[model samples]
Target chain A: MRLLIVEDEADLRVALTMSLEEDGYVIDSAEDGEEGLYKAMNWDYDVIILDIMMPKMDGWDVLAELRKEKNTPVLILTARGAIDDRVKGLDLGSDDFLVKPFDMAELSARLRALIRRAAGKTSTVLTYRGLQLDTAKKTVSVDAIAVQLTALEYALVQFLLMHQDTVVSRTDLYEHLFNEDDDSLSNVLDVHVCNARRKLGGTYIKTRRGLGYTIGD
Target chain B: MNKYRSIRWQLMAWQRFLLAAVLITLLSLHYHLRRKSEIAEVDASLQSALMSVMPAVAPMMGRGGPPPYEPNSNAPPPRYEPDEENNPLIIAETYLEEIESNGYYVTSWDTEKGLMLSVGAVPASASLGNYELIVETPHFLTLNGNRELVVTHNTDLIIVIGRPLTDVNLALKKTRYQLLLVGSLVFLIGHIGGGIIIRRTLQPIREISQTAEEIARGDHSRRIELAAAPEELASLAQTLNNSFNHLDSALEAQIRFSADASHELRTPIAVIMAQTQAALKRDRSTEEYKTILQACLRAGIRMRTMADSLLELTRISGNGSVLNMALTNLSEVISSAVEEATQLSENHPLSFQTLENSRPVQIDPERIHQVLMNLISNAVKHNPDGCTIRISQKETAEWAILEIADEGTGIPVDALPHIFERFYRVDESRSRESGGSGLGLSIVKSIIETHGGTIEAASIPGQGTTFTIQLPLNPASDR
Candidate 1:
């Protein structure tokens, strides 16, 4: 999954990016509300972490503007513990909120939940035929046998299984699994797909010629 | 206690008490004075009756010869000699009859012969002593059947003349009744009227209290209606309104300060927590561990600096007891402060200018030094290296002025006024990296103010920024 972090504090922003990036997610960051809003409207991020206080514009204005154009899942990150701030953020169309000095584990877990809920998957586990993918554990298994997969391969498999029976185009897969900083000319996507097929079994994955990949009966 | 709860009620109670007392006193005075004058008139009439009867009775007492008798001045003489039936006694009886016809009871008692003559049927209960008592002064008495009487005595003839006081007493009784009725009516009317007037007069105060209650309940926009207030209460209302205005602004500032302080502290806390959490997630190289620990240390230092700034700000602004004042040379203090500040920032070019005739000013030297250090360091930090930071002092008749001007990138026009606000920064991202806790200017302003001084900032938004501080020369002496 891809995420956007919009925060003003430099050290906090860098720490959040580094920590969240380690949780098997592609991250894009903006230093202020204006840049954050611009990126949010232009990208297909699974979730956006917003900060309330910022320069150029505030998080509220950015969220209001972004809500007018997109339904991207938003989790507000604020230093204010005031209930009024929480209520206001939620009323302004934020999917979740986390106060500052929050545990990274909780933040990562909430992001995952938001992404899953946005994809219309109620459970943490996604299944395709006899293969099981546990999103929380970040692991995949074929017929009760665990298969070790790289972070990128696991992301690709999860995306395909989330859209089971539908062909996910290469462009959609790349947008979801990689951030803007990733090289577009790289053949990493095909290599990850081939590895997932070998590990999870060949019958569970299928690729539409001249289109994309799918997981179906 | 409940009755006095209302100011109008209390005012009415006191006023009605005074009114009732005044009315009763006047009414009693009128009643007593009227009764007194009526008794005097009755006594005068009794004395006059005595004067008239005395001459006629004297002739009857003499009886030396047939007393010259006249029956109407123009009538013919008596045809026969004065008979026993028509002697001087008959003449005396005629005079007595005249006095009796005028509501006077006349009686003559011969002390020598023990003879007594009475007319107008004086009540038996009238106290006419048998002894040879001669009281010439008139006096009052109540005869039987409660007839008020006035009586007087003559010494020579021992004649007593008495008059019933029925008419005088009746008139006085009526007047007393009327005075009581009128007094009661006046008291009732005055109290009712007074109550209404008092309530109306205090209506503005009630409104002011109601408005104050609403404001206390958090409706900050409400104010006392100055135009509608009574003249007596307008000043009070205005003063109360001024206090409310000040308190409202003070509370708003406190709330904003709390929010800013929390935000300032939370960022560093978040940085440390995030870095530590990320570092402990898995085993990492020694270099990675070193990097994470360094970031946490930086965050910790920032938090500590911010905490110290907040404490200093609170101590300076909270009260005046923290200031240790003394008489000292203003230029010397400025020189020492500049020397210390120069040592703190060697890259910045600092220049100090002082008045030639610098006088000793009353100030807290340590606090003044702190203020100078803060302002100088702020100039150094906000400006680029090698930018000129000038410190100058000037003296007026009653003021010692200090100006710290910087020739660096000035603050933006919008952020200039808020530069001294707690936790405010011109550029948040840049200032955080430069390790500015944002409370430097705030603490400086507090220290200056605590020393009975004023501070103002002027910025041209890219030209430069200048901070001018004015300290009173004798702050501790007169005040």
Candidate 2:
């Protein structure tokens, strides 16, 4: 999963980024609504966690402006747990709403749910041939035997598994596998993929020439 | 924003209604009574004149007297005589003198004497009691140019006496016009007087409302001055002043809460996030993992406590959480809270003085217990190891007071007033070490207030901090 966090509170923004990155989601953040809006216009993200109160502009205006061009899934966060703010955010095309002081687990679950729904994948369990990935349990089984994978390895394999029959480009793999917290301008995709393939078996993923990787029979 | 008519306007309307009803009724009564009395005086004089000539003519009529004073237009009219008392024509002559002297035109008639006529100011064509009415009274005569009063009574002869009504009608008309002018003047004066009175009466209320609006808009220092008003208005002003005082304090508290919420909650989030991110860049050894987890655990604990405190605040301020009042023993509540505190304490010893007596107080047991627990927890958290905390109680004439003294690093004098404010920490560094969210005192204050009690704190920079809480022994309902 890939996500963007647009929050005025720098501490909360950083904290949410680190926690979600630990859960294996590539996260990018903007300090204010203006920067957030600009980024949303240029980049594609699976889910956007938007903060309502921000400088330069507000989340409502950003949502309205973004909705004028795109239909990305948006999650709104507000300091005030007031229901009125929730109703307004939902009305303005927000997919989910969370108040401040949220737990890490809840944040991770909501992000996964938003990303899954956006990809039109209803079931939490994804299967390709004899390989099975349970997103809810975050476990993998190949031919009825358990397979152990690191958080990053699991996320990379799950992305390929979700795009079972399509070619996922290397650029797409890097965007989904890493977040801003990682040192930039480095190619770590090859190492993570070698590890994922080693654990899930080489036959489970097929690499397309000049494209990326996918999981198929 | 409210559309109701002003009290000033209502008062003015009522005054006008009362003045109009009373003034009009009294003026009409005076006019009718005065008119009747003046007409009666005129009739009495005319009847007396006929009586005066009766004794002289009473015997002459029985001795076969001829018809007297034939006003034959042929005998040029005779002049009146003042001393002609023995003459039967004296009555006619007397009226004739009045006519010539005072412009009192008169006409007399009798059964034996045919109609003896004079100048016809009224034409005398109709009998007595016939007069055209003008302005609700027959005191005016514009038609036939006859303004006179005709008075008739039978004595030895049928004497019909008439005095010209012009003067009476003019006098009564003058009175009517004077009355109208005076009544209007009174109404005008009353209108202005009532307006002034209403404005003066409602002036204080306007000032109170203006002050209230200012306070509502966040000018909490604004106040109503009651000393300048009269006793009645002063009471109303005093009530408003009291209400404004409470509202102003509540506004101040709300502002403090919001400020603390944003500023205090960010620090913990920053610490945890930075530590976690720095630790996650690469694989780490077990010792490094233990350090990172320990730091994260401290920050996480602070956030959890802060969230719990925030929830308690919301519950106290919100309408959904109402106090469930029940009779509770103070000793039991104190003991239960202390027992819980002992389990959570990090080696600090707590001492509770055994009460000489126990009283059942009307209170929400759970809320009171929460208050005790918060105070005890704060005591346990702030104090160093081996530092002692003493909890004791006393009874005043109207209150039961609880005293909790901590031998910890006391708060500064400047921060004492804000100790009970949400997320207010005297020493940020020290509180972070102890995982304090600075919301403990605020929760304690809220719970104490919900039980209709007051909590006060006194502390020196280094000696210690003592919290004195006074709960009413008799509930407000009992009082």
Candidate 3:
């Protein structure tokens, strides 16, 4: 996928471009708003990563100018985490935004999501070892047979499917699936996995004791 | 009474010293002048008396008449005696003695009573015949007597007069008492006058000092009265009051500004974070995951826009002079804003119109673009899909006016005035759900105000709402 980064800070820009490039993205960079606007107007990009504070022109101007031309998906990067700035950018027709000093995983995920949204693919489905889940329909089908699953069981299956063959710790699963009031236990994740396994009629999920769980074909 | 009591001791001590010195000086001068005048009077009287008797005595001595009264050649020369009751020499002698007791002393030898004998130790040279005069002595005075006695037969009699020294001392003592009394009275008056003046002069200063103390104790409103005070002090008081006013106003503004800034920052951060957290708490199918991801993207976009607007507002607040400003066509700006807003709304029905002969306005294009985007997006966000958003632009001789009207649920009247305030939302819950950070109108107002334009909102409860922006066409356009 092709991406453009509009950032004034050289170090952050280099870091982001390298990271995104490593993630299989063809990265183009603009040092400031003028260049960003020019690049955005002339070239097609899967996503535009913009910073609010830049020289020549600012992120808002570039975003407004881009919106005037095309509906290119833009993800703003700003040091100011204030919501009003976010709202103003969105109100000006930006696709998404990420605050500075963010984890690379979150950025990548957001970038993926923005690309998916721009491509008009609202329903995202994932399949692993005959366990298939349709995200938009909120339904789970196991081996061409629909399986009734609770919210938690379904979330556990989905997490296992996304990180197939990679160990996900209990803390990671709990943080992603449960609210604060949920009494999370290592055994509770085990129970949910057991229930999902029983419903799938297979032993697809594997547990590395004292470490985490993984899904394998 | 209290006022007098305060300085009573001081007054008393000062008066005592002054009175003592004045009394001493007055007594000394009185004694000096009294002694001088008494001596002059005595001399004048003695001279006059001597002149009267000299003629009588001088003829007798010239005729050698005293030989007629020579009692005997011996027998102590008979101690020549005048008629016992009516002798002029005896009368003059008594008068001299009286004047001497009154501080004027006289000494004399009477010719009728003396056989060359002196009554007050009068000097013989001083009593030479027919040569009468006054003299000052340590203990007495002497004058020439009328009778003359001489071996030369031509001189007949000699008269003498004198005064004792004790009488001059007596008169000086009497004058000392009178001077002491007068000086005491003058000093008493001086002390009373000084006390009154000092008290009057210090009263205002004392009041001011007390008022200052009260103010230091946290009575911020304590103020000194300027009436009846000197001009310089009054001006100082006025300056202090002015400074207090400025301090109060600055403090109030700072408090209000901080509160508004914090409130504006809090709501959106809370919403984005809460929504993200909520979305993360679920596991979803492909579509559910996309929906959750989309929601996150929406929130992320919302937060970014808010940050951008906030940065813009802060930058404009710092220095508005750097904005790229130019003469812009209002109709074009409105049309573009509406078109972009329609796209953002996924092609919500939007209508646009322009008055005939519309004039262009001078503005910062980027900021005005922000303003129009914010306003139109706000209108579309609050309205249902396919609701008509009418945008119009017109130009008078003085101003270029642009307006956006929406048939959405209008803002509540109570919230109208506060709509332009940062993060002030009429419907907080609804705004959060609609992905609004509530800074749209604030940014719009900031942009419009930066361009020297005015924006106002008018809304009906159920009918519709309109926001109008008026920008000055030129510097002399009003003229």
Candidate 4:
């Protein structure tokens, strides 16, 4: 899973980025609404956390501009807890609303839900063959037994299963599993896939010679 | 049923009272004049009857006939004799008979012959007595049950004529009833008409109150409609509407201030909370722990600065007595503030051009110093390193003027007016890095206002900005 944080406060933005990144999700952040909008317009993140008050452009204008082209789930994070602001944020096509000083755990849970829903999955547990992924618990199981996989390997498997019948390319994996700051080598995807195959068994994953990789038939 | 306290009801009450008083006065005057004229008619008839009957009664007075005819005299006496052909008794009875059938009581009394003649049935109450003949004058007398009689006396004979006052009394009675009926009708009509007029006149006031009530109930947009209001009420409604506009704007400003304050405080709090929670989630090396602690510390310091600024702003704005005013020279305060700024920002050039005879103005010296420092620091902070911050003082007859002008990249003209508002910033992103809590200008404006002064900012986008302050020479300070 990947997220974008558009906050004006430097410390809060940094803290949010570090904390969410530590939760095994890729995080990209912008300092103001202009850059946030620019990045949001170009990228395909699972969820965007927007702040209302910003310089150059406000979150409202950013959201309005973004909604013209995309249906990315948006969680409005603002210091204004007034009902009018909340109603306005929701009315402007925001998926969720959270006031400032919100709990990290709650934010993480909300982001997970947004990501899951964006992929058209109802339940947290995604299963194919004998492998099961619980999105809420951030855990994977094989035949009701726990499987130990690194955060990157877990994200790769989850993304592949989410796209299920289709083949996901290497570029798609890089965009979904890593943020802009990551300098992933061209062969890094193969290394992660090889390690995951060794842990979860070889038949659970398959790779097309030129296309990319897929988790199920 | 009583609306005595309302202007409409009171106006009607007063108007109806005056109308009733005038009606009563007019009716009574009419009744008085009518009664006088009716009684005059009865008295005139009585007097004429007496005069016509006097000749016939003279022969019966036993004075013989008349004095012998005298020539060459002022007057001559004609002969009057008692003969059967022109019989005195018959003539006297004929005159008496005419009066008797006409509802007049007639009585003639002769003292010398002890002769008393009466015609018609007079009431016992109206019987003539000898004492009534002592004077030769006509007098009005009330006979049986208020019937009026005219009594006339001659040198030797007394004649009494009485008439029933039914015609006079009936006419006056009719006049009285008419007065009452007309007065009552007029009063009823006036009451209803006056009530309607008053209500119509006061209708605008009622509408004004209703609109004001709606505004009081949180419909601040509502206003009294004045298109059809009367001139006096139109002016009143206009004044009330102006006040409502002012109050509405004031409340809106307060709400914006609170929202901005919360936003400013919440950001730092969120930073502290997120950093602490992240650090507590896992064990980190000493260097990582130090980084997280430093981040929390910075956020804490920012919050403290904001809290102090907010408290200072509130103290100055919430009350006038918080100012400690004294007589101080504006130039002296400016000189010290400029000196401090020179040390604080050595790279930025600061200059103070003071007037030679800077007059003493009544002000809060400490607050004024704070204002100077805040403005000077703003100039130093917003401008480039080598920009010149010029501080100067001038005086008018009534005010001492202080101008703090900066020669640097100025503020945009659109944001100048709102710069003094609490938590307002020219550039939010730059303001954060500049370490401004955003309450500095608001506090300065409040302090100046408490000292009966005005502050204004004029900015030329590329040239620079100048903050001009006008302090009263001898302030009627609020404190």
Candidate 5:
């Protein structure tokens, strides 16, 4: 995946670049808003991780500019965990948001989700094995039996299914479904998985011991 | 000084009244004692006169000799022929005349001759040797010595004996006039002295009062003069100056706090905006575009949270007394928060454990919920992968305690004290990564205090950290 990182902090940019590069993503970095915007407009990237605070132009303006020319998926990385910024960014055509100091695994997962979403592949009408997800109807079917899911559960299952056959870490799951800075507790992911498993049957999603969860055919 | 002018009248009036009362009392006492002494002198003189005259007159009356002329009597004599030709009688008469002229009258009675030996021109029918004597005149003398004499005594005798009274009266009148003049002078002097003394005494007080008034009107620098004033007034002035110093310090602190808060908020907002604009300036691949967008979103969220927290902290600090408290089911509140936190963290596991005897606590549920959310969120954001976060509740005898513990990079001991301070971040790099506003913990502390609760944080470097919140159970009922 090709991704662009726009951050003013040199250390943070280096850390993020190193982390994303390890995940097989071709990384391009910009130190400030002007350079980041120049790079974003010139290149075709699967996802963009833009910081809100920079020298010349801000994240909001960047998002607006990117949206003007393309419907490409964009993810905003900010140091703030505020609601209005998220709404504003999303309103300006941001695909998702990740607060700073985020884990490497979560950043990878969000990139994957944004890529899949940009390709118009975020759907639930497909299935692996006896599990089926119908995005149009907002329902999940297993072995031809309709399975009901809460909105959050459906999103969780869709995320799992999109990255099927791959180990999706808890941090990645959190970033995809929620923003960065989410409270890290052992039961939060467990509870959601428990709910999803209960509706879709436990065997469809496999827990990988200490690493994360995987869906397989 | 114009500052002291306002209280000048009040100070002067009080002093004048006090001095006038004291002076009037002293002058009145002086006059009263003087009058009493003069009356005493008159009584003593009257008693002495009566004592001397009564004793002298009683002995004369006891002797049975011819009645002696009083020497101060005046009476008309009866018509007597050859009274002047009788040379022997004339000489006796002349002696009588000399005595009579000296204010006396003499008479002698001869029982054999059936004639009264009269001198000093006594009345003809008047007898000098009779026990029952009726002079039948305006001026009559009963000698009480067997004689009767009609003698007109000068009515001015008492006047002559009291002749020294003129000198006394003149002295008394002079004294009275002097007393009137002196009393009036003393009263006037006392009033003026009293007014001057009172004004002098209250001068400092007036200055201090006016200084206080100016200070109250927002002139915080106003100070009263303490030099050369009375001890008490000096101390009062010093105290006032000290209070103004404190006020000035407080105002300075408030100004500093606002400036710092604004500075902190503006930097992050500006950075986010600038970075995003930089990102948008380039053309990129789908992945690059996505990454740029993600960075923008993150910065946007950070700015928003900072702004929100700043607002919350300001609100909490502005007024602390008004708390919207209600009966809250703490367990339910915790459960709901846990559920929301879990949903937000797609795969991160969260655990919840509660004591079986947990009960509802009275608090502003929303505020307490925010506190729990902040603590739990912090734990989650700071921890390493595969680390477990524990959310648990326990009840003590007096409080309900909720704890959020995380196995993460713990806080340094040096940073612990300042963790709850506004805009304080431990490990700035990591804090920026975690997208912290630095106001979360501060807001949590403020909310807990408002609910009459306590919160404490303990951490071990590279091990873990736990945030404990203890809320007073039934706080409303206790009150």
Candidate 6:
């Protein structure tokens, strides 16, 4: 899964990025609302974590501008505990809200729920042709047998499994595979695809020439 | 027990007291004047009669010329029966009748002959005084059970004269009744009409007091609705309303300040909690754990800094501008502030430089140093690591001015005026991200003002910002 955190607090931003990255999410972040808005509009993210108070602009303006052009799911984060502030953030088309000083586990669960709901799947586990990806446990299985896969390989498979029938372009795969801080120009995606094919019996992973990767029977 | 007296009641009581006193004085004066004039008229009638009768009767009794009527000595006989044609009885009878007809009575005596003659009704009991003009004025006496006023003359014979005084008494009684009726009506009218006028004039004050009471009961919205009140009470209502508005705004400010301070604290707390959770997620190398600990420490320090700044700001507000004065070297204070800021800062190197010497100023040194630290720290917090902040000084004859200028992303022009106000953030996100409590400039301003100084901000967007502070060399002693 992929996520974007738009927060201005340097320490909180860095800490959240590290935590979500460890939870098997490719997380990108911006230090202020303007940069956050630009990146959010430019990329296809599974979920965007937005802060209501930010420099240059605020999450409301970002959400309003983004809703005009995109349907990316957004989860709001704020320090304000006032119900009015929370309601205002949600009323501006954010998908969910979490007050600051929240538990990392709770944030992780909410993000997973948002991503699953966005993918049109009602469960944390997605299956295709006897292959299952347990999103919460970060594990995969083939025909009732667990397949030990690297974190990147697991992420690639889960992304393919969630989309299932749609043709995911190289750009979309590359964009979701790594965050803004990673060296996306490298062959990390190709190597991860090679490793996933070698592990998944090499036939279920199919690539269309001049298109991107896909998963089908 | 409390005495619950309305303003109208007190007013009416005072008005009634003053009216009754005035009417009593005027009615008594009128009664005395009427009686005095009536007595004088009767005396004049009696005197004219005595003058005519003394001359004519003396010739008829043959005791000629002003001598026979000496009241204490001998006199002519009344039996001589002055000539019917020449006697004074016949000569003065018609003249005396004229005075007598207007309610006078006449009597005369001959001392040597020991005889008396009189006309008109006599009193059932009356005492006559010896005839002398210098002795007594006329007085009212009872005659035939009727009141009369009599006078005397003694040039040739004892002569006593009188007029009935019954009309004077009846006039006084009628006047008393008329005055009593008119005075009661006037009092009644004044009581009701004046009471209404007073209440109308004071209606604004009554409304204001009622509104104030309602406000005290926690409805801050109520106000006096007096439109056509008198000028003095109108101004009173305005002043009271103004104070209520000020109090309401002060309460609003208090609420906003707390909300803002809590907002500044939450992000750092979130960072600390997230970092701790991440570290304990799984086994990690010593280096990674150290890095997590460092992150936690930085977040904790940020929270502490914000908390401290908020506390300082509130303390200054509570204490107002009361300074603990001390005579101190201004340059040394600036030098120490620069040293402390440079020494304590790890990420950003903030520098302060001064250009001129200063006489020792009367100020609270610790507080002024705190103000200097706040200004420099604010600069360091906002700008990048390499940005240089310059502190310079100049002086007029009476004031010492210090300028803090920064080479960084400057504030916008519109934000300059409110930069020193409490909880006023030019950029809310940046202020919170930089770990500011939004009270730094306000604290600096308050401390400067405590030293009897003024502070202002000047900024150019994308270039730099400058803060100028002017402190008096000598604070006002009278304050």
- What tens digits encode model 4's per-residue C-alpha lDDT throughout B241-286? 9999999998998888777888888888888888888887889899
Fraction of the reference Cα-Cα interface contacts (below 8 Å) that each candidate reproduces: 0.76, 0.04, 0.00, 0.72, 0.00, 0.80
Docking class of 4: medium
Report backbone clashes per prediction: 1, 4, 51, 0, 121, 4
* Per-prediction TM-score: 0.81, 0.51, 0.34, 0.81, 0.46, 0.67
- Off-target runs (Cα >4 Å) in candidate 6 are A14-26, A55-57, A80-92, A101-217, B1-8, B31-174, B210-229, B241-249, B272-298, B318-322, B327-360, B376-392, B404-438, B459-466, B473-479
Off by over 4 Å in 4: A34-44, A56-74, A80-97, A180-191, B55-137, B147-159, B276-325, B383-386, B397-399, B412-418, B449-453, B458-464, B472-479
Better of 1 and 5 by TM-score: 1
lDDT of 3 by residue, B36-68 (tens): 787666555445555554454433233222223
Interface RMSD values for all candidates: 1.2, 7.3, 13.7, 1.0, 11.1, 1.6
Ranking by TM-score: 4, 1, 6, 2, 5, 3
- Local lDDT at B240 for model 3: 68
lDDT of 6: 0.74
DockQ of each: 0.70, 0.04, 0.02, 0.72, 0.02, 0.51
* TM-score for the A-chain in each candidate structure: 0.96, 0.89, 0.58, 0.96, 0.56, 0.94
Taking the tens digit of each residue's C-alpha lDDT, what string does model 2 give over A1-217?
7788998655466567766776667788997899999988877788899987566678999999999999889998765556777888889999999776565667678887887887789988999888999998889999989999998889888898877788889888777666656664535777787888888884887778778888874
Judged by DockQ, which candidate is best?
4
What DockQ would candidate 4 receive versus the native complex?
A: 0.72
Ranking by DockQ: 4, 1, 6, 2, 3, 5
Model 4: fnat (fraction of native contacts): 0.72
- How well is each residue in B1-479 modelled by candidate 1, as lDDT tens digits? 88788777778878998998899889989888897788777656555655555566444333321223232348643232223443323467654443433333334433322222333322223343433333456454545423223333432233444555567778988998899899989998998889888888888888988999999899998999869666779999989989999998989888888778887788888989999898888899999888888888999999999988888887779478887878888889889988888787767878999888888888888888888888877777777555788989898898999998988888888898898888788877778888889888888888888877899999887678899999998776456
Candidate ordering by lDDT (highest first): 4, 1, 6, 2, 5, 3
lDDT of 6 by residue, B235-299 (tens): 88888888999988887788888777777678778888988898888999999899988888878
Better of 2 and 4 by DockQ: 4
Scoring the B chain of model 1 against the true B chain gives a TM-score of: 0.78
Tell me the lDDT of model 5 at B26. 70
> Per-residue alpha-carbon lDDT of model 6 for A174-215, expressed as tens digits?
788787777766566777888898898747788887888899
Error (Å) of candidate 2 at residue B187 is 3.3
